[model samples]
Target: MAKKFEKIGENLEVKNIVIHQLLKDAGNRLVNPKAADNLLTIGEKEKTFLGNLDKSYHKKSSPIYGIFAEENPKFRDCLIDYINGDCQFYDFSINVMNHYKIVLENTVAATGGYMIICEYRNIITSNDLLLILMINNKEGFVIDEKSLTLDNIKNLDLSKVDVACLINLTEWVNIENNLPSERKTYLSFVKGMKEVSYYFMSFIDVDNKNTSTESTKRLITAIEAYADIEQWDRNTKINKKNKVFTYCHDCIDNKKEILLSTISSILNPDNPEHFQDFATEEAYRVSEIISGDKVRMKFLKTITYSDKEFKIEFDTKLILDNTIVLDGSGNKLTIKNISPILRDKIKELSNKNA
Candidate 1:
């Protein structure tokens, strides 16, 4: 099977990494304090943590989307200065941590987590990138290295990423140097499931213009057009539609975004780029990455009919799975494998009528 993101972790280079602990103050409810010193060491645990984060950042289906926010460019300017050798990595990281704290304090409720500022290169493209990740630490017991005794320790939680952002330094510089491709977005970040991570966006000063609903609608139209152009049989068309619908529904349920490339691969794995090229040529306006809109996605997952007296709904997969068969001649549905409760209810109704 092909990987979800084929280019992730390819020719990746980790230049510098630093993590600072953010803790909520007990005395002061609003103020959150940072640890005395940052962890500059990149051990095996850090390596695994960074690897997972890199994959999430590059995954086209991820909720991460590109943005261009020039109104408030403080963070972007700082990055540019660092890239120009105006400051050392450690100093630049401290500024990033401090700025994050300011955003948290001024805006919504402050969150406590380990703020990781990493400078890496060549993950998705040959671009020197800086990724910032915020993750809560797990409370666990560990043997102390000095005393050789079990002590309470806080370990970085590798399972969940609370918030993250990737800054494409090379792309930004190229844009500044009067590059040709002006539509490029150098900043991309994860849109977390909750509002607590909204501060991360404020810290970076970027805005996402593309919405998930519009993208989904465009995607559906493009797929239908592509299927028609290829002259697929009715059965083949239905199967492909169901397959893509299931993929989109899963992404929405999992709080992940839909990737056009992933959908293309699913539609035509032998020629993965075939669908993408068709979409481009047809001018569908489907975004490369789309945040899954749960409300909009409901239309794709189920078939439903409703009236004053009767309302019936069933999963789209039920038809193909042979559980619910449709007869065109009779213009009715044949529902098989009825549940015991439903069967009993129908029997009771029949006995009462008799």
Candidate 2:
């Protein structure tokens, strides 16, 4: 990420040096030798000029340095919208702008007296604001006192131009912290500004300088966390490309007769005579479609009697269908004349159901 901004700092440094040299040369040509020597000292003139500008515009506040081309309409519009509360942050552009190229060349020409320097100001802070507009080529001639024209300003070949906002990170953090958390609009604005700042910082060439403070480190951590959550959400969406479906079927109707027979035996343990009555009532409650013939046959098959007197077994089917059974003396008698096994097969079904 830092590679993206690798050339920006270098470009700015080279331009600053060239502008300073031009100022020195201009002093040499416009003043006496001794006076030029004092005024053109290595860093004296640049320092003096900056000091005077700071005093005039930011008397009691830290200075903010913003570097940009004067003619880039997108950049200008973004700045205006942000200042006017119409946008959250100054939207930086990646496409190379022709105006930025013009400014780059004119900064050098302005120092050489071939172009005039122009300054524009707006209140970025209560006590601090510095805005400079660099004009070059024929446009600069309109305001040049010396009438120096440099067509060479148009010949400077530059492939890319970068813009940056220099701010006191500590002061920015303090202001952000003091804002009420309930002010969502303001908070969102601050977050957008931080995102822009972090992107610029990725390539701003800090040059091994220990510029990180506790506050800046915390802010960076927050931005990284937000990035991670966004990545996770994106991955989750990609992973949900496949879908599945399930269905269930109930087959309780198939086992309805068996369930009814077992429940009847369980309810009438002491009186086997009432087993058929219990089954009929339960079957009607469970399913209205159970036929009378099917119910009677199922009841008969479920009940049987063992005669201890004659050691003979008489099935309920034979008794109910024929209405007769053999007694202990081998005499034919009514089905009700026979004795039933006190503990019958129904008890076994009852225990199994339990």
Candidate 3:
């Protein structure tokens, strides 16, 4: 499992910010990034866009644990140059915008949006972070600062964030200092629309570090830990656990990766991100997207308790149906209703003995 860090956009002190427009002409397959002369002043609109950016990032991101790919290190190179003062923030933003355009060009049927690039430091941890948000041009309008008129620019609807990435510069720098087991990936990103977001991941240049099994294991552990802290009764715990298991099984059957945010919502709909926050704070480090492991996750459907004298196994569904009951205080278990097959089997054995 990977070590978790503070979410990217929390407690931000915006040091620099820039926005570039990416638009598509009718009938053109690719979009282009418009030229920008200066950084935007950190104002109310920007603050409003940024206020919940971190929360959205937390809810939407998938972790990438490895460093930049050696063969194509354009993003890493640009980032290093900017960090080393070889390039200004404006120039870096332009470079990223250009790269995104290149990626979009190669991607068939790829579209474009407003790209907001920001460099900020966490007020609490003082960690330097970079955030890139891509908002579709049609959803909202960006106000023109000069004339206070709506123009070609667009302000992101934080609620509708589709594609974005948050890079932890401090984590990247100190990645080598941490032990192998302690190293968490520096990049967290989300591909908003399933079909349209692959290029966005490629634009960021990161490799996934954890395997499906590891991610599944950590997720299960996180859920169990959270339930323990909540002090849920056996039936409630089993019911919720079964719900998670069913969702995961369905995803696995469809060969899809499980979404942490979805699981969080399943655990607590009123507080959608509560389980996610617990996983992070408790250092379970569950990625927002993880592949389900069929072999390891199979146990979640049914629970087993065994001893030298006998073995007991039952489906978690039975607990919720009131067919099975657990007495935690007395360390006793009761089965209210036995299946007809089991009852007949017991009756046959009794007649044979008699």
lDDT scores for all predictions? 0.64, 0.26, 0.68
Local accuracy of candidate 3 as per-residue lDDT tens digits, 1-354: 534545333366778777777776434666756756788777655554564565555543233334555655788889989988999999998888888888777766667766778788776665788988776645345644333223442233344555677787887888746733222457665545422255666787766445456667788779878888989887887788889889988766653457788899998888999998887664788766664566666545678889999998776546755788888786887888788999999899999999
Candidates in order, TM-scores: namely: 0.54, 0.17, 0.55
Question: Which lDDT value does model 3 have at 214?
Answer: 67
- Span of 10 residues, lowest total lDDT, candidate 1: 141-150
Q: Model 3 clash pairs?
A: none
Give the residue spans of candidate 1 off by over 4 A: 1-10, 25-29, 35-39, 43-45, 140-158, 176-183, 191-196, 209-354
Q: Residue by residue across 293-345, what tens digits does model 2's lDDT show?
A: 22222212224356756554343345544656557797656555433564566
Candidate 2 backbone collisions, by pair: none
lDDT of 3: 0.68
For candidate 2, which ten residues in a row score worst on lDDT? 241-250
How does residue 332 of candidate 2 score in lDDT?
Answer: 55
Higher-ranked by lDDT: 1 or 2: 1
lDDT of 1 by residue, 1-354 (tens): 532544324346777877665665323446454542444465544454556567655553334455557766677677767878998887777777777667666754656666768787864456788888766544332322233222332332323556677777787777667686433566666544333245567678865544455556667668878888889886677677778878887876664546778889988888998998777564786766665555655444557699999998775546645899878786887999999999999999999999
RMSD of each: 10.8, 36.9, 13.2
